[model samples]
Target: MRKLIFALAPVIAMGGITLAVAQNATTATREVYVKARPTDVLSSNLIGLNVHNNAKENVGEIKDLIVSSSGQLSGFIVSVGGFLGIGERYVVVAPSALKVTYSENDKKWSATMDTTKDALKAAPEFKYEGRWSK
Candidate 1:
């Protein structure tokens, strides 16, 4: 029994030290507390927002957001060429191609693309293959 205890002494001490370190990590105060935005913009809120062209014309509404497996933004699906949601096509666009800005007077975030409505409508449409989601 004494021989067994001696052999386990170093292992027991190492485990205790590891537990203490883990406890210290959890109890330590956070040094960084930065906020993402002054106003909390929910992902749900952005889903159906109006999408506009650079010409200030109401082109379409945001259909969906495409994200990669790594959680990076892949693109946006803008519903174009639709009259009240009819005859509309969902087009995928590069995220960097659009400009998103907050309007202080309106108290809302607006999205704008440099391309025209007709141009976006002519682009390739987005279709789900049942394997991936928007």
Candidate 2:
């Protein structure tokens, strides 16, 4: 019985180590986001969402996004002007230009830009093409 217990001790320790290693591996690839209070949002949910400035001025809405082949977000196409998007035009801005945050007080997601509506309207139009990435 002593010999059997000694042999089983090594196997039990090995099994415990294996279980710990498997748990670590599973967590390594997992993405963690705070539930219900997230300041982050998926791009699909952000499309056509209203954007405002710091002073709570309505600016424009996000129209489209440009993504790199390496899966990096390159630019955002913001549509400005028009009523209810009737005559809205598209302008390109770097992804860094917009700040996305959830307002705890407002209980909503907000997108803010440094520039104003008029300036955004004056920005050069961005036309999407297959060769734009090239």
Candidate 3:
């Protein structure tokens, strides 16, 4: 029994080391980004931003962003036809629909769409429920 215990000790220690190496291999598979590109815009700066039309009319306010599982931007939730949040409803728009720009002189970000407030209000509304619940 003493000899058997001594024989298993090295195997048990090797198993623990193998388990640790496996854990490190799993961790290394996840990608890590260390630097931000110039085109990257912080999501914190986008929320609550007023969306305007080409005619300089405020169409909607950016309420939320939808990100896909593949790490891509899926949609932008815009609130339209709201009077101090009383009658507002959320509408999901494609990220390409909004023309987002940054002005170097004013150091401000602006978003514009070739649409009107009435057009946005007439769009299909998105309700916060289930997976998108507030």
Best by TM-score: 3
Which of 1 and 2 is the better model by TM-score? 1
What is candidate 2's local distance difference test score? 0.61
Off by over 4 Å in 3: 1-26, 29-33
- Note the Cα lDDT for every prediction shown: 0.60, 0.61, 0.68
Candidate with the larger TM-score of 2 and 3: 3
Clashes of 1: 0
Clashes of 3: 0
Error of 1 at 105 (Å): 2.5
For residues 1-134, what per-residue lDDT tens digits would candidate 3 score against the true structure? 11111111111111011101111112335322234445556677679889999889999999997765533466789999969999998899887788777778999878888898888889999999998888
- Pairs of residues at least 3 apart in sequence or in different chains that clash in candidate 3: none
Model 1 is weakest, by summed lDDT over 10 consecutive residues, at: 12-21
Model 3 / residue 130 / CA error / Å: 1.1
Give the top-scoring candidate (lDDT).
3
Better of 2 and 3 by lDDT: 3
